[model samples]
Target: MSEEDPDLASRRIAHESLTRDDPTGWFENLYSAAADGAAVVPWDRGTANPLLTEWFEASEPNGTSKTAVVIGAGTGWDAELVADRGYQTTAFDISPTAVETAQRNHPDSQAQYVVADLFNQPAEWQHAFDLVVEIYTVQALPIALQATAIQKVGELVAPGGTLVVIASARAEGQPDAEVEGPPWPLTKATIRSFASAPDLRLIELDESPSPSNPTATRWRAEFLRD
Candidate 1:
């Protein structure tokens, strides 16, 4: 018999532990550190994601009248870019520290930065946004919660509006191998499964090596609410 892979077993255990409804207090701590102006989030590039910017510039000209909502708007980079496209953008994170930092960083961008958890979004937020941008947020949670996140994304979009997601893609059956992570990688099939919900219709799915990290590929998906 083949020897058991300890690494895979450990990963499963870790994921199972993390998937529970642990209070999001740690997220608040992260924001607090950032608010103190010393914390450096690994995913913060200090600027908008270039590929996302490109997509916006290309699609904005053809998009319908709609306000944009950016989920997990860490540090406001993507939110700023979305606002630059002339959309009325509202961005939020569960961390107050992150929201404060975002407000400080983009003092003049007019992007409404708020602190809100996706799992329990305010009732008024339902079906309120025309454009929903989901970037690196779903993968932060355990794989089992991905469907919940995807459902929330759909809930935020207005009828016939669009939802765009950007995430790191992994190979099938390979569990997350990182020691500790906020930027968890997900497989393309997993992403498709999330986007395949009844309320959202998949429009496009594109995969290419991330320009910033040639060793890893990124998946960009566009979905429309029906």
Candidate 2:
């Protein structure tokens, strides 16, 4: 028999979680396993996402005197980048191990790392951030949960705030049946749901070749709240 794929353990944990009808639970399982050296988090790149950096360069967002949050902050590279940009940043993950690791990864990090569920966030977080960065977190859940996830992410943006989403993109009409994933790709229509909130406007949505895979597409969308 061929050796198991390196990410098979993570996929198995995700599948079991999904089978239990717990879409977000696998995250803690995976992160805990990684912490114990029994498995690895496939998405932990150990550096700030380049797409986010590209956005920062292009938009020159002035985070000074602003507040930001990084959803599914993982090991905190993205949160650190946002903190470095001068925002009072709060980064959160559903997994406590992940949050602890992020805190450990950046000992002197300015960002507040917390264990927060995307589905049930704190009351204070409602429309409370000037910037919200959601990189691949929504896509990591089942496709059926996309709309609710998008709406919750949007609700975090304060008046005049901006929300940036980066994720793997699929063709608009692509069949969901064909996509088996712990990382289900998002389509154009699904992405538009980010602006479904009455107060949010989709300012930009770009579908381009993924930096990690030239043939695969990536979506970098930006939304602004009224």
Highest TM-score scorer: 2
Candidate 2 lDDT over residue span 112-179, tens digit each: 99999999999999999999999999999998898899889998999999999999998888799988
> How high is each candidate's TM-score?
0.83, 0.96
- Cα RMSDs, all models: 6.9, 2.0
Report lDDT (CA) for all predictions: 0.75, 0.91
Candidate 2, clashing residue pairs?
none
Q: Distance from true position, residue 168, model 1, in Å?
A: 0.7
The TM-score of candidate 2 is 0.96
lDDT of 1 by residue, 3-83 (tens): 334334333433444576553445565555445543445567789877688777767644335698999998899998888
Q: Model 2, which residues run further than 4 Å from truth?
A: 1-6
